[model samples]
Structures are given as structure tokens and as C-alpha cells.
Target: MKISEFVKQVNTTKDAVRHYEELDLLRPSWKNDVRYYSPKDVGDFHAIKEMQSVGFSLKDVQAIFNLKRTDGCGSEKLIQGFLDSLDKELEAVVKAEEELQQKKSKITNMILELKQL
Candidate 1:
């Protein structure tokens, strides 16, 4: 399919698709100055969006993708790198959750004190 159909199928904007292409995340085939997207491209687009949904920045996603592509799927180094990234992200999320809980507790205490006044 072409860019139009691909965008419709993916339920995303053309500019988003173009941006992904610019980032080398999406590689549609070119023929006579026109780009043609395959089903695999659609799958890649969904994978990119899924990664973004889980707090992966485009740069992070690109690095992960590049690592897989460069090192191949079965490379132990790639698996270890991916695990390291996930561990870092998990730690950050846990820290953020703790901070949020603390803030919520502080706000609750302030509200209770205000009620006494």
C-alpha cells in the first residue's frame, strides 16, 4: 500500500509516519520516486507506537531497534542491553511512583490539618 492507505490503516497522521521514516524507524520501499508500504511496515509502526505508549522515547526506541538489527535477534549482548534498559526504566518508574505516593500523603495531611482550623 501507499502512504495514504498505510496512514489510514494505522490510524495515524502522515506527518507521524514521515517522522518515523526520518528517524529510520520506518523504511518503506521506493519505486519510481513513490513509497510503498508493506504489511511488515504496518507491524513495525504498531510496535513503535506500543513502545512509545510504555514510556520509551523515540530515541530510546530507535536505539533498541538498531541494537536488534545490528546485533541480530540471537545475540546475547543485545538481550543483555535490552534487559539493562528495561531495568533502568523500571527503576525510574518505581521512583516516580514512590514520589507520587509521598506527595499524596502530604496533601492528605494538609487537608486534614486544614479541616481542624
Candidate 2:
């Protein structure tokens, strides 16, 4: 079906379909200013939505898609990339938590000082 029909059936916007196509995630057939999608497009959409639902970034989706193209199967390189990203994210989370705790301590000290005045 055409992109419009596909969007209606899949509950997605036309722009979103185009964006995914641009990202090389979907390869809908194109002819005469119109695009048509098949089951593959639907699968791509589902894959993207599923990943996004689970908090995967667009870069992550693109990386996974690229890996699939190269490896034709799950690759250890992709797995390692994901692990590295996860580790970096975890480190950022820990740093943010430490910053939050420091701010809490500072605020508590100010409150105590004000209370004694």
C-alpha cells in the first residue's frame, strides 16, 4: 500500500515514515512521488517503536540497523558497543546522583543555619 495507507494502518504519521526511510531503517518502494510499504516496513516500524519504548535512542536504533546490515546476524562488536554505551550511561547516572546528594547537603546546611538565627 501507499505510505498514507501504511501510516493509517500502522497508526504512524507520514512524516515519521519518511524520517525512518531517510534513516535507512525502512525501504518502502517509491515511484512517481509516492512511496509504498510492505510487511518489511511494518517490521521496521515495530522494531523502532519497540526499541524506543525500551528507552533506546535513535542513534542506538541506527547502530543496530547498521550492524544487522554488516553482520547478517548478531555481532559481538555490536554487543560490545551497546555494553560500552550502557556503561557510560551508568557512569553519568552515578555522577548525577552524587551531584544531587551534594546539593541536598548544601541545602540542609543552609536551612539549619537559618533556623538558628
Candidate 3:
């Protein structure tokens, strides 16, 4: 389907489709300068969103995608790299959440003290 249609079907935005194209992460079938995403592109979009949810920057996600798509890399190696990246991202998110919780706790304590005053 066309980029717009794909975006609609996938419940994603056009900018996301364009950004993925820019990253070479979504190479749609092009005809007469118009781009049409196939089922593979849809699957890749889901993967990208999943990665982003896990805290991978677009650049990082693109790099992982490139690594996975690179002709020279073995499929097993690419899969391993992606899995490793996911692991690191998960760790980073956990750390960030912990820090956020600490900050929130401090703010809550401050609010309670002010209320007492």
C-alpha cells in the first residue's frame, strides 16, 4: 500500500514513515516517485516501534536495522546483535526509571513538608 495507507493501517504517522525511509529502515516499493510499503515494511515498522518503546534512539534503531540488513552479516550474528541491543536498552530504561522514582519521591517529601508548614 501507499505510505499514507500503510501509516493509516499501522496507526502510525506519516513522519514516522518518512523517517524510517530516511533511515533506510523502510524501503517501500517505489513506482513513479511514489512509495508503497509491503507487508515486510509493516513488520519492520512494528519492530521499530517496539525498539523505540524499549528506549532505542532512532539512530540506534537504524544502526541495528542496518546491521541486520547488511549483506555481509550472517543472520545469526545480526539477530544476536539486535538481542544484545535490546538487553542494553532494557537496562538503561530500568536505570532511568529508578532515577525518576527517586526524584519523584523527593518532590513528594517536599510537598508533604510544605503542607505541614
What are the RMSD figures for all models against the true structure? 1.2, 3.4, 2.6
Per-candidate local distance difference test:
0.91, 0.83, 0.85
Structure candidate 2, residue pairs in collision: none
Best by TM-score: 1
Clashes of 3: 0
**Candidate 1 on 1-117: residue-level lDDT in tens?**
999999999999999999999999999999999999999999889989987876888998898889878999668878887788778888989999999999999999999999999
Q: On a 0 to 100 scale, what is the lDDT of residue 41 in model 2?
A: 78
Specify the poorest-scoring 10-residue window by lDDT in model 1. 73-82
lDDT of 2 at 31: 86
Which residue runs of candidate 3 sit more than 4 Å off their true CA positions?
71-74, 111-117
Local lDDT at 8 for model 2: 88
Cand. 1 TM to true fold: 0.93
Better of 2 and 3 by lDDT: 3
Candidate 3 per-residue lDDT, tens place, 1-117, comes to 987789899998899789778878888988998997889888989988888887888988878888877744468777788888878888988999999999999999999999999
* Model 3: pairs clashing at backbone N, Cα or C within 3 Å: none
Poorly placed runs, candidate 1 (over 4 Å): none
Q: What TM-score goes with each of the models?
A: 0.93, 0.64, 0.78
Question: What ranking of all candidate models by lDDT puts the best one first?
Answer: 1, 3, 2
Residue by residue across 1-117, what tens digits does model 2's lDDT show? 997789988899989888888888888887897777898778889988987775678888898888877875468887777677667667877999999999999999999999999
